[model samples]
Target: MTNSAPDVPATPEQLRRSIADRTWTSPTAGILDGYQQANLVVVPASAATEFAEYCRANPSVCPLLASSAPGDPQLTYDGCIVDVRTMVPRYRVWQNGRLAEEPFDLTPRWREDSVAFALGCSHTLDGPLRRAGIPVAVTAPPVYITSLTTRGTTRFDGAVAVSMRPVEDDLVDTAIAVTAMLPTGHGAPVHIGDPAEIGLADLASPDFGVFPGIGPNQTPVFWNCGVTPQLALAEAGLEYAATHYPGHMLVLDTVVAA
Candidate 1:
């Protein structure tokens, strides 16, 4: 909800701690510059395997980072420890495929049968893109459910979700090349130019996140969004589930190679 930048800690651990303490609750788009940010998907142990398979079938949008053992709240990757219960700034709790609540922490909702999966987030590339002289939005970009359907699993099937960024015509290739180096950030764009080609009719109104407004001479570039799993989760009608609210990622100590 809030787009204004809050004073953030210098390290990822500190950032996580701050988030846990409720000191920071804004979206993680442009903050914490180089550290990797992860999209979260916590499901029951019964659906974990199928969900993991779903991620594998759609790597572009769900580049699996790390998963936690059932009933465990922690996920470790490259020496970084992330507590799924409290580290993320916000969480979306789903019940039977319907979004039940948007909570600041998952502590109360964490269950004995819960399994958490971390997916690569496009926010990880924001710092690199900005450093490359490309103007990046401070808040999360608009996300739309496209006509493109992801390769699905028995329990998970849905249309692909993409986040759109407006890039100057000249910087389009530079933006692509810069992001391509980091697969962990949903590397490169999935679509460019016309939004209708991707089933996006109106850029002004998005299915998720606020539209950042495309300017003249700037082309709309779309990337496979980490939010894709939420669509699957909705379609699956799972009894219980949790995910990072769009753009509110778990900051990881590991930096993506750019």
Candidate 2:
């Protein structure tokens, strides 16, 4: 599932340009190795208050990175500039509790009252995980809708989503230790070993992304995923909303993890 490229941009800005110019439209996993990537979610100004609270209530799954002012596409944090309308490689437009379309650009759908939110991405820990000898899928890792729901109000209450990565039995501790230091990147594993413990029926079928190959002596490790908010947004029955395509995250100019 690797988005293999011999000329992958080396810097965050360069990578963003590649995405902006449509040179790279794949998942951001394993790209801009040390930088923090983010999940994009845009909602109308009317829903911003509840959505912000939802993120605060579910910090592990919806860690807020940068939120744009209504009608403004610019989001700057840690010296990085994210143009919400074009930074993401893919976007999912939601309407009335359903996904309306998956588009590469948001210009046509952008609204004057839209507020874009950047949620911390789990891909921020991929480098640390790999450095610790834990294998992360090259493409977007598999995500699941957990039975757990956020402590949000009626407008934002929905299932908690988690991303899965298979870790060797021996390196589970190492993976946990390494990712624990990255609070912005969903931190440590919320569940380990049994998938059914968290209501996951099969690892082969995921709510998003491709199923990772788990070898012998390896067990599935789960982390809070930024996609949690998207599920909530769908349940909220908003008139219109948008989010990054699973794994097509916004690479930022910040080192979130070692």
Candidate 3:
């Protein structure tokens, strides 16, 4: 879990070049180590208010790490160090309830009034969980279909998506306790039993990303996934919208504590 490369201490440029060269196509959890990685949600100006409302209604699911002003793809930062337009590894351009394209960068799809949002994800807790010797059955963050309904509105409505972590039964309590120390990362498990109870019929069939293998002694612990907003956005058929591929999150320069 401690994937700290002093050579690449989680910078925006490193991410930009990595994506440009197509050297990084998979999840981003183990790449940045302790640095927090955030999920992305890109939407048009017209739906910004409705999307904001959805985020406000379900803070834990979205967390709302940062929201850009309308017409801006770059997040508000000093000297413009963090560019949401090209930093994430991969992006999903969704329209009409389906993915239109999966691009490595936004140069081809950038537009005015497209607000980019960064939300908390379970990847923030991966370092701690792996440090505890818990064999994370989840190789990459896996989004699960949930029975929980996100507080919806006139513009968007959808079921919640949760990330699963399979922990040993005896270690579940400790795992929860450790992540609780980092509340900004959608801390703790929301559900600890069968996925069927959460409306998910199978663990192998995730709506997005690769599925993690569940071992005999492991139990799937569910946490609110940041993808919840992207799902709602996709469900609304925004005509034009982009989201970071499920596990590819932005690595922030600052540190987050519980």
Candidate 4:
């Protein structure tokens, strides 16, 4: 489905209110420019510690942002209160590690033992990339499950997921440098040039998100994506879990420096 631009509010809190009210449910890219965006993961209290450890083990793919105590619907970062069940535009419900449904509000499925986690999203780097004169794709970029595996904890172990963006051949270095400074945004490109080296045979067909074709002078650069946790959740095969839909992230009030 194509995403249409909505009337964006001036602040992250306002945008979040719109999202909670179902006024804005599209992929949040290029909106709320300087604010940090985050990927969401809600799991049962039983698996929360293991999942948290798994994220810490692989910082590039899952940069830990903030986590909520079990049964707590809210996550706070930068003194901003984020209601995990309502703040996100859309959520993917997982049953037995499989995607069961995509829901706008997670309230119906919220469990008393549920624990929510927020991870750094690469979307936070969009402003810096644009300021560096790099072209960022208007649509969500393609994400692939790589052959490379992540350092896993007891319950979470699986291949890493990487998001691809076509960068001008000349600005590849700048892209890396610009993103590296923002550790909260998944940092820098993990792979560059060949997708096959990472087991992506067809660049045209990605495992997730849309594939914006590469330009003649552009090179495909891959970054460790927040979606990595989703793959791990599937691998763990938990009875129930939840995550933000790919590209639809939780907009945070935390202001990031470009």
Clashes in model 1: which pairs?
A: none
CA error at residue 41 for candidate 4, angstroms: 0.2
**Model 1 lDDT tens row, 102-194:** 999899999999999999999998899998999897888889999999887667989999988999999999999999998888999999999
Q: Weakest 10 consecutive residues, lDDT, candidate 3?
A: 1-10
TM-score of 2: 0.94
In model 3, what lDDT does residue 203 have?
A: 89
Q: lDDT at 158 for candidate 1?
A: 92
**Cα lDDT of model 3 overall?**
0.75
Order the candidate numbers by TM-score, best to worst: 4, 1, 2, 3
lDDT of candidates 1 onward, in order: 0.90, 0.86, 0.75, 0.90
> What is residue 75's positional error in candidate 4, in angstroms?
0.4
lDDT of 4 at 250: 94
Candidate 4 off by > 4 Å: 1-5
Which lDDT tens digits does candidate 4 get at residues 204-251?
999987789999999999998888888889989799999999889999
What TM-score, over all chains together, does every model reach? 0.96, 0.94, 0.86, 0.96
**Model 2, runs deviating above 4 Å:** 1-6
Local accuracy of candidate 3 as per-residue lDDT tens digits, 1-258:
122323443565576566555665556766655667788888888887888888887877787777898877678532344677778878889877788898877767878879888777778888777777776643576777788887775677788888887788899998888887765688778788788988999889988767777879888888988877777877796778999976777776655443
RMSD of candidate 4 to true structure, Å: 1.6
Give per-candidate clash totals.
0, 0, 1, 0
